[model samples]
Structures are given as structure tokens and as C-alpha cells.
Target chain A: MRIKGYVFTLFFVLGVIQDSVDGRPLLLSLSRPHPDSAADFARWLVSQNSWGVLNTIASDLGGAPFGNVVSYSDGLPNKGSGIPYFYLTTLDPTASNALKDQRSSFTISEYPIGTCGKTDPENPTCAKITLTGKLKLLDGNSDEVEYARTALFSKHPEMKDWPKGHNFQIFKLEIEDIFMINWFGGPKPLTVKEYLHIEMNKVAFVV
Target chain B: MRIKGYVFTLFFVLGVIQDSVDGRPLLLSLSRPHPDSAADFARWLVSQNSWGVLNTIASDLGGAPFGNVVSYSDGLPNKGSGIPYFYLTTLDPTASNALKDQRSSFTISEYPIGTCGKTDPENPTCAKITLTGKLKLLDGNSDEVEYARTALFSKHPEMKDWPKGHNFQIFKLEIEDIFMINWFGGPKPLTVKEYLHIEMNKVAFVV
Candidate 1:
């Protein structure tokens, strides 16, 4: 009986300490970064989320903003680059749209990360980010493509086995503007340079 | 010892039967709808999800496609209207942008619903839907407003208590096009009429 009790206690402690859902590696914890820390919060949002809606200008739809659900990664676990990379094929409208007009935005929510708790997904405190920029296709031969593939495949392991005939190419968003709402007030002012250059290791997230 | 074993088995079976994570109500089971049942699948997707990325054309950002994370409800619990209604404020760019250009698209994924299992979010089988149409703000006095408010507040109770100073108004997507991908093939052939008119009760969901 004592041994069983010890095992259950250990499991409970581990669950509380880690507290990460969906098997995602923990960099950000149950409690998020301070909303005032705009750059840190923005970077943490991008780093922690593996997928978001990638929006693009659909020429066929009379220039309406077309949003598609997509999987993306900033970098390998814990070592996020703050630049979201995608594995896309021209067969999809988003990639085709990007080819015609690179203007795009990727939106991620804290709700799916399961840290939003009881707060509504739309609640400002739940944390949502939109990275607006050019969705550029990387040259297949470039060194960055290798990094991107490693980053994407590491997070979404099944991507490595995705059908090759679809001719998936690597794409990265060159973030020019950041719109993030993490608290009661409107968007926190964050510059692209500040978002990209923040030393992620120095951010000191409470785990 | 016999009673303890029975209790453990009961817990294990209950976990498998109702495998819903994140405290979301289980309407669609772990095994999702057939991709061939396009209307059923689409309605299931919308009814099962509480929030999604609402895309709008940002006139200020040189007509870039801007996607924002927002909470939305189609109707109440199992009684879904299929027309996604949102509680938005003009202070937000999405609402303001819609006032300028009603053209918009809302994207939702099966991933957040927790039914996709290990399938990569971007995987065709994981299921995603984008409803493109005009985002029209409902007349505050209309009977639909009552339905919309009830729908929105029931799914997202926090929305009712949001700051009245923000002037949150009810808006809904007048869906014109349905773009859904649920399997290996590209988007399923679904029309606005088919999606909205589908008798959700007739199409059986295995729960």
C-alpha cells in the first residue's frame, strides 16, 4: 500500500511540475509571460505554438483574405528562432496565393496550447498573435532550407514521410509587423527586430 | 483485490469511450466523420469548434490578408446554425476592417477539437474548413441578435461580461464558399446551400 501511494504521489508531482498537454515540450509554463513584456510574450507565443491559420490574398476571391489551417515551427524544441517556417505545396491555394502576392499573416492562439485555462479564447488575457509579413519561398538549395526542414520535421515527425510527389517546398514568413493582444488593453507594441532578436534563453519563463 | 481490478478496468474503459481532452463536449468521437460526407463533416467541424481565425483584408496594410484569432459560435451545443456568429468590437482591426470590406474567411481545424489524434495538423486527413463570405454586423434590435447572443454567450459565457465600453457587437459570416479538406484528395466539393441546409440530426455521428 505504501509503494502504491508513493507511485501515485510521484505521478501527481510530475504532472504539476511539467503540466504540458498534447506532448508539446515545455518552454512556456501554465503561467505565461507578463503581458508587459511584449517581445518576450510574442516570441513565447510563436515558439510554443506548432500550428496556426496562414492567411493570404486570394486573387480568385476578389482579393478577399483567405485563411487556411497549417502546421509551422519556429525551430527545434526549446530553441525557437522566432521565424515561423512552413512546408507547403503549390497544389494548395495558400502557397499558390503566396506565389502571386507574398503578403500574408499567421495567427496563433494561446487557447490550443491549453494554458488559457477558464478564460475564453477571445479574452484578451488568453493571448493571440498575428505576424504580418511576406510569405517567401526559400531556395531549395539554400542552407536555411535544411534548417527549416530540420525544424519542421522535428516538431511534426510525420512531415518527413509526407508524399514527395506533392513537391512540398519550404516557406518562411519575413515578419514585418506584429499584432499581439495578451491583456485587457489592445495590442502590445512590438517591433519585428525586438521580436526576432530577443535572447529566448534570457527570457526566464516560470516553469 | 477483485473490486480494485474492476475499478481500474472501469476507469480505463471510460477514458477510451470519452477521450475528449480540454473539457470540450464530445459530439464527434475520436473516430471522425467520413471525408465523403462533405456536409456532415463540415457541420460537425463547425459545431464541435468554439473559436477560429477570422480573416479580413487590412486596407491600411496595403490590402494584406490579416488573420485574427477570435471566438465564435454557430449556434447552441448540438443545435448548430452553421452560420458562424462572432462577438467583436470596432476597436479590433477585424471588426473595423469588416466595416470597410465585408469580404472575409474564417478557418477552423480538427486539431483543436482533439479528434485528429496523431495526424499532423496540416495533414489532409486532419480536416480543416474555411468559410468565405461577407462579415455582416447584425442589427442590434433584430430577432437574430437574440439567437446570436444566446449562441455566443452559451459557448463563451465570458463574452457576456466583456466591457460594454468596448461596444462588442454581434457579427456573422454570410458564407458564400465552402473550402474543406478532410482527406488525401484536395478540398471537398461543398456549397453554401449544402453546408447550411444539411439536417444535422439526420447525419449520424458515432459518439
Candidate 2:
């Protein structure tokens, strides 16, 4: 009986490890909101993804649109405030390009979250959102900078240990226009006001 | 003896499945070349990833750079040909935006390939590449279109079934500049010629 108990426990631990590898935690598996709930769905997509492509006008490349992979956060987990915050260093072209031309956009995909299942990343049902706005650097001394840091560090624990000599600083996209495609039919008509004002209650989360 | 054999076979099957999930096929786990081999490294990155952010100038949004999630292919599996090909539809902003302004870039991250392991997506060590140049629509009748279709369908099988009314077409990035950061210092100094011409022998693959 003692030997059998030991074997059972070993299999149980192995099963848990496999589940984590193939499945997201229960909290993350919450069913996606209906596509008609554009505002809520868009915000949920932003809150769940950890990274995206940050685009900027590259003056060096003769004004070509440049996209770079970056990590960002809106708030702590489910408490997203609908604003995407970033940590950038001027050593990269994205920051320099933004300084030269503030016009930019940040895009995230629901495909990475594993909720898209077997759908192609380009499938409208998989969902993709682009937040078009100016990329602005936050004042180092501002209170928002403190909050942004906490939010970023909480999601990406490794950021705090990134090289200080690189001079990484806080940046945020002041979203003016929202473009999202979550389902069939053309882009959904979602106003910036509707997207920003979506109440947290509308976004259901499985306990 | 029969019961013990049945238990052994069950464990063997479970182990095989777990290994398949954790280890990419022997072909993909081929070790990454030294970052110094610029062209080989760039081609490897493009061939290994199935999707990326395709950026285009959104003229309607005050010329802000808009990045959208897209699936792409360089060629058929191990025969990648150094150029990234995409299937796009004008119904989507990325395609329409490209038609209005050819200036664009395609960005891909190594993080999705599962090779980044514990490294943060934004960590310089976790490779990222952006190919900046023109987003040109290919002539539907061209021979390259046939090649592009085969390359794309082989990787993203579901794409072949995407809505036909959407008028999906082939587009390719005419890469003029390569910005890749696979290691700490900064973007590697790689000219388009060097990035396009490196011989395949330089990139080693594990058997």
C-alpha cells in the first residue's frame, strides 16, 4: 500500500506539470466575450497579452513604418485601465523614431494567448487590436511613472533586473484611434471613448 | 506479467507525447548559429516563425505607423529563400494601408518559437528582427505566386480555407534594411546584400 501511494503521487505531480505546459491556468481560460462586445473584448485582449509590435516612422529608412517587438502592460492583471504602458530605451530605433515623429501604433494579437485554438492568426475570429496614438515619454519624476513601473514589474518580473546602463525609461501610447477585428465583417466601429470607459464588470472573469 | 507489460506500454506512450510537446522535431532543434553569421541567422529566424507584425503607414490616421498581426512564409519548410511572403486582403487595414503607401516593415520574434525559454520577450538575448522596405503586391499570374501559395499553405494550412470573398492576395517585403538584435550590444550592422547572400552551409542543422 505504501509503494502504491508513492507511485500515485508521482503520477499526480507529473500530470500537473503536463497540464501547465499544454493549458493555461483556470483564471486565464475564461471564455472570450461575444464579438459584439467590442469595447470589452478589445480591452480584455490588451490586458491579457504581454507583448506586441510597437510601430514608428523611421526617418532613417526614409519614413518607412518600422515595427519592433516589445513588452508592455496596461495595469496589474485584470485591473487593466485601457492604457498600454511601455519601457523603452533610446538606444533602439523605436524610441529615436518616436522622438523624431510621435505618430505611432501598438498592436497585440489574441493568438498568443492560446484562446485562438487552431484558427490562423490572421483569422478575424482570432482577434487583433491596434492602438493608434502618439508615443510619449513620461516625465521621470511623475507619479504615473511610479505606477507604471509597479504595473510593468508585476507582469514582467525580469524587467527590474535589465541593464541600467541602457537607460530604459517609461513610455505610453496616448491612444487617439482604436482599430480592432475580432470577428467576421470589416473592422468594428469602436470609439476611443467607448473603449476607455468600459467598466470592469462587463468583462467576466472566471474565479 | 501481462499487467506489468500493459502498464509499461502506457508509460511509454505518455513519455513520447510529452517529448513531442516539449521538444521541437529534430529538424527544428538544430542549434542556432553564432549571431555573427548575420544572413544565416536572419533567414533562420524568418523560416522558423509563422507570424509577425506587418506594419504599414495608415494615411487615414495622420500617417501613424500601424502594425497588424499577420502570417507569412519565406519558402517551403527547410528551403526558405530569404524573402518573406504574406497573404493579405484589402478588406484589412494592413493590406489597404500598404497599397496607399508602400513603405512598411515586417517584425518577428523568436519568443514564439519556444526557444527563448525563460528569457523575457524583450530581452535583447531573445532574438527579434524587423525587415524594413516596400510592401509590394505580387501579380496574381506570376510564377512566384504559385511558389508563395505553396510556401504559405504548407505552414498555415487553415489559411487556404480563409473566406474567399475577402480576396486574399500575395504580398512580399522588399527588404532594404535589416534590424536584428539577437545579443546585448545593439542592432547588428548588417547590409541588405550581406543579409541576402550568406550561403546556407554556414547555418548548421542537427540531424
Candidate 3:
């Protein structure tokens, strides 16, 4: 019970930070980068559990987004937990259909990084992030898939139960482009690096 | 010479296969996302010095589109090869200025996913992917910055040379929104299960 409270507290503080940052007027950082901050988010990711949704956008097919739950095996021998990758096997047909169409992009969003519940029903944990990239069906035999799966299983052993069948094939998500909304609220967009790594995990203070 | 030519030819053929599966028509393979016709491309990626380029969009302070080069670190602890992570660093004041001015977005074309030519234009390999996402200064201790760096660097040893400075903070191209262009060319996309415990060192026939 106490652990739950602590988790709740962490989320609350996180909200405050996001709101404060988003509330401020927008400013560019790189125009030179602050390597320190980038590293911050990455480390945080290394420290926690990675659960998120894998999404793809085939606007040509439909305007609605395609989403799925994914569990990551983050502890690959060489990759950082901060840069965790996942192996997904969904029975949903949306993914398979997308591949057949040979579309141009897919959007992946992280379920709100922190205490993912409703503070604002309309935008609750909509700290949703979308990554745009060219989707490629990896050759079932290549080492990439093996690496991807190994990376995923290292973190999540439960994934071994993944469904398999006649039409079953595995595809990988190669990130191409990215966008992130404020962890706070409004249009305080963020960079993908900020949310994915350690920042999301360590995001203890909000507003 | 023959080896390099073999590598280059292999690269183009892979590109075509990548285009067919990702850029062409959409195929649905959720639950079991087995992307079709993406095999050749994956093999090609492995064969080509283990790094490739992803042409993507970066949103500038003004909300305009710009191109940015994405350096892929396919080789993990052995960074010279293996499924590398794409990277980009911002040390230019102009980039910081632009980010400070506008919260931007970047679109990435995942083709040759490796280090781009230097932004300065003098270096032959100096490719610059566009920049997006507003940049911010690290807090005094900059817990965030530290976190991100370790996550990425621990995996990509070459990351040690990544741009770093006192006031300068380095960050990565975290993708948010993405799409792909596909047309079946060589190998197909990998299946979900094979992703675990896999090795990615295969080369498909080149065009």
C-alpha cells in the first residue's frame, strides 16, 4: 500500500514539472544540445520496467491509429536498458493488413510514462508520444529478429507465450521520426529522447 | 574494391525490398506482426558496415520541415556492427536557438540507418538530419542528462566521441510519429518470436 502511495506521489510531482515546463513559452535547445539532459532520460529508462504500445499509421487505410500492448526484454548484452527494444506478436489483424498494403509509415506511442491515470479525463495520461518511421518486415531468418527477440526476452520472460500460427510472421519497428506531447499538458511538445529513457522512469515531480 | 561494390549493390537491393514492404501497400500483422517482404533490406543493413542512414524530418522553431541525418549504431558493445541505434547530436548554437524558439517535429526516412555526414558539409560522411523538439538546459545536477547518455553510450562505445561540453547538452532523435514506403524487393520483415535470442548477420542478394 505504501509503495502504491509512493508511486502516486512520484506521478504527482511529475505532473507539476510537466505543467511548469509546458506552461513556459517554447524555446529551442540545439540551435546546441545539452548532452547532460539527453543522458538523463536515457539512464532513467535503464532503471525501470518498459511497457508501452506499438502503433502504426496507415492514413491511407484509415485515420484512426493502430495500437498494441508490448512488453520489452531490455537486457540485451550490448543495448542499454535505457534504449530498450521489444518483440511483439499480436493476433490482431490490423498489423498484418498494414504490411500487405505496403504503406509508408507507422506511429508508436508510449502509454503515459508516469502514474498513468486520469487527472484530466480528456487528456489524462495523454502524454502520448508518436514515432514516425518506415516500417520494414524483417526477414524471419535474419539475426536482427533474433537480436530483437533476445533484447525483449531478457527483460520479459512472459513473452515466450506469444501466439504462433500459419499466418504468423514477425516484423520489427525501426524508428525513423519522432514527436512527443508535454508530460504536463497542452502543447508542450518534447523530444523522443526526453521521455523514453530515464526521465520517464525517474519522473517523480510534476508541475 | 569488389567487397565494397558488393556491399553497395547489396545496399541498393535491400533498399528496394525495404521500399516494397514499408512504402508500398499496407499489410496488417498485429498480435503476430510479421511484416512481409522486408527480408532483403534487413540483410542488407547487416552487410553494409553495420550502419545506415534514415532520412527524416525535424520540426524547427518555426514549425517548418528540415532534413537531419541519423547515425545508426548497429554494432553494440562491438559497435562496429550489429543492430545499431540511430543517433544525432546537437552542439550548434543555431540548433539550440531554433529549438528554444519553437517546439519542433522531425520525420525520419529509415533507409541507411547510420551516422550522417557532418552538418558542416566539408566531411564526406557529414550528413545532417533535420532537428525538432525544443531543447532545454539541464538542472544544476542534470540528473536527466546523465541518464540518457549512459543508456545510449553503454551500448554504443563509439558514443564516447559524441558531442559533449559544459553548456552543451547532447540528445538523441527519439521518434514520435512515423510512416513507411514499401515494395517487396528482397527478404521479408522478421517475425515476433524470432526477435528473441537472435543474431542479425545475414546478407541477401544485391540488385
| Complex DockQ, candidate 2 | 0.41
Which stretches of candidate 2 lie above 4 Å from their native place? A1-31, A201-207, B1-29, B199-207
The best-first sequence of candidates by TM-score reads 1, 2, 3
Candidate scoring better on TM-score of 1 and 3: 1
Model 3 sits at an interface RMSD, in angstroms, of 19.7
Best by DockQ: 1
**Estimated TM-score per prediction?**
0.87, 0.85, 0.32
Predicted candidate 3 versus true structure: per-residue lDDT over A130-159, tens digit per residue = 344444566778876677677666544545
**lDDT tens digits, residue span B1-207, model 1:** 797656533432232244444545544432345577788779878987888999999988888899999999988776788999999999999999999999999999989877776678999998999999999999999999999999999988978889999999999999989899999889999988888887654433344
| TM-score between candidate 2 and the true structure | 0.85
Q: How many angstroms is residue B43 displaced in model 2 relative to the true structure, after the best TM-score fit?
A: 0.9
Writing each residue's lDDT as its tens digit, candidate 2 over A1-207 gives 787656543432221111222223434423455677788788878887789999999998999999999999988877778889999999999998888899999999887666676677888888999999999999999999999998899988999998899899999999999999999887899999999997654444444
lDDT of 3 by residue, B1-207 (tens): 797666554443342322111122322110111223233333223323222222222334222122222233333222122222333434432244334443322322222222221111111122112112332333435654555455445543554653344233443333232222122231233432332123442323323
Order by DockQ, highest first:
1, 2, 3
Which lDDT value does model 1 have at A180? 95
How high is the lDDT of residue A108 in model 1? 97
